[model samples]
Target: MSIKTTTLCALLGLLAPAAAIAQDSTASTLSRLLECKLTAAEVAAFTDRINAEDVQDFAHAGSDASGDAALSLWKSDAPVTAWGETSDLVHLSSTTEMLLAFKVTPGQELARGKAIVDRIGGMAPRPDQAAMEATYGWKGMDFRKPLSDNRNVRVLVDLSYSPGWVTVGCAYGDIQ
Candidate 1:
């Protein structure tokens, strides 16, 4: 083969994987979840995609309040591109809500979180970062979208930054 052709082929080969990794970013995953209705079947498919295992012992403050009021959780640490590294992913389902939480690198949280927020229609205005940080260790915003049955799905995004880690939680369910 000609030298020019061979070098071009090699460069293209290197770029292919980089392009794939960028498409498979955490932001994309979160965007997909934001679009989801969080139905039981949809949740099952998501867990299968991530290979998340059931958390048999998972419990929350109200888990014991009643027999059917228990919370269900699934978690996976499977390596996927996020902030140039892998981060923990958790899914929680309860009678009234579904939540997806994943960790992103501290410094990139706001920019990345906002990107996810921008994808959905009717999103709230970007919260003030300075006031948010001053008020607490996390920043949160909320918006609601109507579903086919006329019920509204309320979505909440919370970005929590601690000394060593940053976690972004997205929760959605019937507004009522």
Candidate 2:
């Protein structure tokens, strides 16, 4: 299958299992994903926890590292409430760092990005239109909040918007 098709399936596959939970919602899953909160083990068990037979186009892009979780990514077609469907989704993990990156559908970048910043824990004063444009040169801004529970695991929410592309996601790990 094409990369786009595969990516879309992978993301749906990721969310489908969450939807089955008693009270889980797409926003909940999105929050966890944006925070880079899902552990390697949880991600690995996705295929088994959620029946592949039921989710269309779902594929567990399998990992190879035995003890350490190698870099892995999951894409989706699931749309967030108040936010449009993501164009792309990615997750990366290493011994010292983990990052989640996703491209938000146009027109919803600002609201979605702000909501994500709030969900992950806000930055001082919050970010606004002028701030994003001034700091990031039009349609760009980033806010970081070190996990209060774990100072070592810092996380940040970033939004980048350009003529034809917009990415809103987060990164966590040994970030400076």
Candidate 3:
């Protein structure tokens, strides 16, 4: 199979729900991107922090217990770690439109971010949901090949609801 096909197949395998033969390819892709393992405590802490802070810029599917629990898991155990000058969690209309921005040292930041992305997975834009109002951008400092000088990486998560919840993340590193 081609690389795209292989990726889609792997994604489908990872996200196929029990007893469901049919799968949403988009959902599968999104889920695979977010497949980073997270600890329950970490998820809980992150969720609690977002909740307490009342971040209303992102869309949250889980407004209930299950959602809360999932959010807790996502926050705590996920591989996407925050680095220098990261934004506080914000709520958007959908996950796809939300962007994660952070500053890091040039040489290591992209690798670090890529590692996180590899662990977590990729996301695509949702067709049914409303897009985000804000556009996310990053600023880079000290440009260099292989590792740019002090720069910011911006990750945009494209979330779509396949009658369920799935989040996909895409990152643009070494923003200059």
How far off is residue 176 in model 1, in Å?
12
TM-score of each: 0.37, 0.35, 0.21
Residues 80-153 of candidate 3 have per-residue lDDT tens digits of: 32322123222232222222332234345545444544553342223322323233322211111111322122
A best-first ranking of the candidates according to their lDDT comes to 1, 2, 3
Model 3 vs. true fold: TM: 0.21
TM-score for model 2? 0.35
Residue 75 in model 1: lDDT = 36
Q: Cα RMSD (Å) between model 2 and the true structure?
A: 12.8
Stretches of model 3 off by over 4 angstroms after superposition = 1-96, 121-176
- Give per-residue CA lDDT, model 2, range 41-100, as digits (tens): 443344333344433332234443111323354444443221232433334343223334
RMSD of 3: 18.6
Residue lDDT tens for model 1, 1-176: 99999999999999987766544543355344434444545545554544453322222323232223222333332322222223333334443343444444656655654565555455554346457657775554544545553333343444442222222233444433
